[model samples]
Target: MFYMSTASGIIFLLILFRMDLGKYCDSTSRTAKAFANPLRVKDFWVLMTLPRFWAFGLFMTGVCGIYAVYDQQFPVYFSSFYPNPEDGIRAYGYLNSSQVFVEALCMLFAPWLVSRIGAKNGLILTGTIMFVRILGSGVAVDVWVIASCKMLHALEVPILLVSAFKYIAGNFDSRLSSTIYLVGFQAAQSLTAMFLAPVAGYGYDHIGFSSVYVLMAGVVGVCLLISCLTLRSESSRTPCSTVPDHAPSPPATTAVV
Candidate 1:
């Protein structure tokens, strides 16, 4: 089933590519370049010097760790609530479907929300929602209650993930946008998983599922505080052109005898 789904996705992307519908409408490409070179390395170091960059990286790490724990443990937590295992599984399925539906709706309105509130404020909103959702999950008694929290989870994805991308692109030079994003989103999340996965497993073993959620809630709450304190409003952001130029000119080649 997974392979079939993957194949379907590949085919759909191919169709889009064939029709040239994959092009970005904006002149600026938001796509990240995967290959590393001297220029990207220099840009990355320049980005690292900013305090806001560290704040954003830490925020991404904490949120991704919380998500990893919730994704792994929620099934066990859900199954424990019902006497019949199948009933618990069915309930979990319903919650997943509802969350996906909510996420779809959130995506439809995400652009408008970003336009109104801006990326920094959007992160604040989503970070708060994520904190609330994780806290609610820790104490939720009914499946429907958890389902409602899952809807909030959908709203967080666009605000945290999409807005973070926009924040990097808009505030920094276009040359550095992709590198900064890759570091903040992908590398930070990967590092969080590597360290936190074992800790979360130990937590589930010793303290049970609810404790894990509570712990995650606290972590996300801290991240929210950091984001609120460090993230600047859109109006106050430095224009990309005014950002310090860090891209290095290519080294001159020497002709060897």
Candidate 2:
């Protein structure tokens, strides 16, 4: 919820720097006129053909689940920086070591990961890391160690994002694809997230943080296995890697509300 506000604010500021909100609508009209019979949803409904994309999402979700557990332990991490327990909130602001490096990696090499490894194999590798990392984080209760574990978000967010864009752009029509691919997924994710978040948070507070972490990992593992079965078992080797570069990422404007 906080990051949602932050992202919206940043985009609004970016819009102000370039053009007014009215112009944004006008630009959309122009863009619509520019292409005909573009990417459509009917083209690609079955997602498994695109390699372990579902597995990749599972892996990412596992990594994301960690923060839910970690946040519940904030007082502990906060205590380290501020000797005064009440000043934990202030210490949160001063911690800079992990964030700087993580952001740098996301900005610098995310493209290279997609361009170099290709989304298929790259996601599998990352997903594997996701499974391993979650299990490890739960096993170790060290606060600093958990903080260091956050470096995975850099990988988790962008890797899943770029791969999703790559797959949708290649498989769907450009026009309707915007609504179906971008808006549709965002909507579904937003709805599910609202419900899942509370369970994770409540689980952390009551049942135990480690239990929540393991459940999150279990969710991811199930998805990963399903994706593997669907993609790997298909003997039909009709190459689906057809989209080229210059594929604009659904305007990068669609976010689940």
Candidate 3:
């Protein structure tokens, strides 16, 4: 159940950003780049240089990590806490339905927000929203508070996605823009989950969910600090496309000198 929800959640969230991979996204991007590689697209570089992209990517890593970290455990935790596990599951579904509605609004608002304020600034604003939503629940530990946090999920996960694409679209017409942008997000989700989840799970098994919440809150707060520092002073005029992904592959050697 947890796995299905997460996989589907990412799908729904991405759709809520108001774009599609389409049937031939990969084929199309590759074909377009056959003549002039996306690296040669001037706007692609312009978008890449914006500090907001990195900031957006960074805070999103934390945001995704929070959601991913608990996916394997949250429903179980709720079930144990509630007198009726069935009731809890039903409630979780209803909460997700509300979030879907909010996500639809965000699909419209997010682009406007990006256009008016720019992707970097837009992300900073949204990150604050995510922080408040997460941090507000720290003092309270109950199903209702947890459910309230789900409402924030609409913005926390989806807006950053919307912002990332807005920056890509605004600055780049290169075929590789969407591929590169989405790949960066996937890499972010993968890396933190690989390293942090186990340690977090250990904390949960030994201590409790509250400790895990404290740890996640601290992580989000630190990420927000990094976002503020890195996201400003960047624009399509000055992009910073330094995604936290693996380095590009080396070119093939023709022959030994």
Candidate 4:
């Protein structure tokens, strides 16, 4: 851990000195203007009223909620495959480490994948894979089957991390990117886990892990159906206009970035 932190610090120092950000007027001024008046209460209310916000928020809620449940419960589920508790822990450690390694590798391809499919389709693809992976884990009788399903995390998480932010930026006001990400995505995810985690715990107590997981997957299925029906379709790398019809246009003096 100490060596890793030291190495990371050295890399950060190198980037700080080596990277040229250009003049303050060219870079910082534009960026500062881009974020100006980003979070007025009126704008936040308007944001909340948008259907796209709810649709994407629902998507985040479903995917992130199940992921939270899986994080808490998967070890217990996998442990049952081994009679010895220590053996189960060791096995789980290897499986989880492989998932992290695979996720890192997949992250490199995420940008390319999202660009080809567009953000909405990228989300749908990942959600579909998530449904199958979670369901497979629930239905599998053998440890190998479960392990294979769990490995699907490498596909789902990396794509989700990339495409979700893109979806937000494309469908909403660029100036409000921070507000949308914080209020729409992050807050929704936190709330979903807060409310759903206890329910999942209850399900585990009453119905066991497999049954609970299947039910969670069902929830994801419902969210995916909603997304498919309501989420806007767009071309690869398209820049969507964020101004709504009901809202007045920005003044002529307002700089377009």
Candidate 5:
């Protein structure tokens, strides 16, 4: 199903590119160039050396790790609080439904919110929200309290996703947008889950969900500090085309006899 859906989206994009719609996507040629030769090791090395890349990549990694834990364990934790297993399941569904509705409403407001506080600040706000949600879930005894914390997901999703895209576009070369998203965000999330899932599973088996959550909250708190120190300030951002000026220039090519 996922493959089919992705194929369909690709086909749709192809059709758009053929039409007049693709004209708006000025960075498409740059994207084509980046992937035009995957065998180019130099390009990959250059990307790795950029401070912004690692800074944002680590932020994505940590936040994504927390998100993975919440998705897998929160339902189980939520269910445990009820008198009956079936009641817990039903209540979790209802709470999740409310969150879906709230997500829709919050998506409409995200643009305004990001505009007022810049994308970097928006990211900080979302990270702080996740910290509160994870810490609150771990310490609270009441089901209602945890449920309230879960509702923050509605606000967190829209803000985090939109701000991340804005942050990358505003701070990186426009042509590299697709490459940055794939490596910095998508790959970072996948890597975090791959390495952290087993540790979290072990923690749950030995220590329990609350302890795992508290540990995850600490990881996110550390990531927030890294983000604050590393992310480019909004006032200092230049045009995407010029953002690469801060990166160290490639060493002058040496002539090999």
Candidate 6:
């Protein structure tokens, strides 16, 4: 793990060194207005006032919390059901490998799915699937059943992630896109995981794995409900007008990277 981390860091630094900032921004004069002072608090507050942003934040938090609990507790849950620890480990390894394969396939189709259903609807679909996956995790009868649930769960990863980036790109101004995306998607999820991990551990210890999953499913269900009520359709919401017509277009592709 340490070696992998070190190699990843080295690769990232190499990529950074090779990147051309000029391609992203033509000239310092044109870029001056785009570089807003981070210390200015008003803009951040203004973005926070949007209802859609709050919905997205809540959705991210719930989904991430569900994922964290599943990732951290699944081994314990699986082990309890099996007679031997080695059998449990082997089953889990198979499940993990299946998830990786499913995720790869999902990545290939995610863009087309998002484009067909629209971002809000795509999120709703993924959220529904996630809820079902978590519920199944709690009650699945066999290792194969649990593996199937994991495969369904894996589909959400690419769909939710891609839809989120598309939603951010379509709704926010170019200047605010990165900030809103990071805060609503990444930071909110991180914060949720931080708070949820301990609570999840406690629940697992006291109530058993099934009960923990039931609780997590309830939380994710509420988030999906909130998203359904609060998130507006793309046609219904106004796009940001501040973005320059000539500004680099938002990314149209989605990949694991």
Top TM-score hit: 4
Compared with the true structure, what per-residue lDDT tens digits does model 4 show for residues 1-257? 69998999999999999977655546336355554434456776777787777887777787766666666778888888888988988998899889989999999999999989988998899889889888888898998998888789888889988898888777777767787788767888788888888888988899988898888888889888988877777743334534433333566786789
lDDT winner among the candidates? Answer: 5
lDDT of 1 by residue, 1-257 (tens): 69999999999998978885346434333332212222545556667787777877877777665675576667777777789989988988878778778888888888788878998888788778878887898999887777677677778786666788777767766666666778887888877888888888898899977888888998888777877878767788766532454445469999999
Give, for candidate 5, the lowest lDDT window spanning 10 residues. Answer: 240-249
lDDT per residue (tens digit) for residues 1-257 in model 6: 69998999999999999998876665544354466323246566767887777877877787665666566777767766689988888878877878888899989999999998898898888889888888898888787777777778678889988888888777766567778878988888778778888988888889978888987888888888988888767888886533334545557887786
Off by over 4 Å in 2: 1-34, 38-97, 231-257
**Candidate 2, 1-257: lDDT as tens digits:** 69998999999999879875565445446354434224444334444343444433343344333334444554454354456766755544444445555766786777778767655555555555566556555665665665555555556667656655654444443443455444434644554466677777677678765676667677666656654544322234344332222335474566788
| Alpha-carbon runs more than 4 Å astray in model 1 | 1-4, 19-40, 241-257
The better-scoring model by TM-score among 3 and 6 is: 6
Better of 1 and 5 by TM-score: 1
* TM-scores for every candidate against the unseen true structure: 0.81, 0.59, 0.66, 0.83, 0.80, 0.81
Point out where model 5 deviates above 4 Å.
1-44, 242-257
> Judged by TM-score relative to the true structure, which candidate is superior, 1 or 4?
4
Cα lDDT, all candidates:
0.74, 0.53, 0.65, 0.79, 0.81, 0.78
Which of the predicted structures, 3 or 4, would earn the higher TM-score when compared with the native?
Answer: 4
Point out the higher-scoring one by TM-score: 2 or 4: 4
lDDT of 3 by residue, 39-147 (tens): 4455456556665555556766876556566555765665554788888787777778898899887777776666777776766777676666656554447777777
**CA RMSD for every model?**
7.8, 10.2, 10.5, 5.0, 7.8, 7.6
Q: How many backbone clashes does candidate 1 have?
A: 0
Clashing residue pairs, candidate 6?
Answer: none
Cα lDDT for residue 218, candidate 3: 75
After best superposition, candidate 4 residue 254: deviation in angstroms? 23
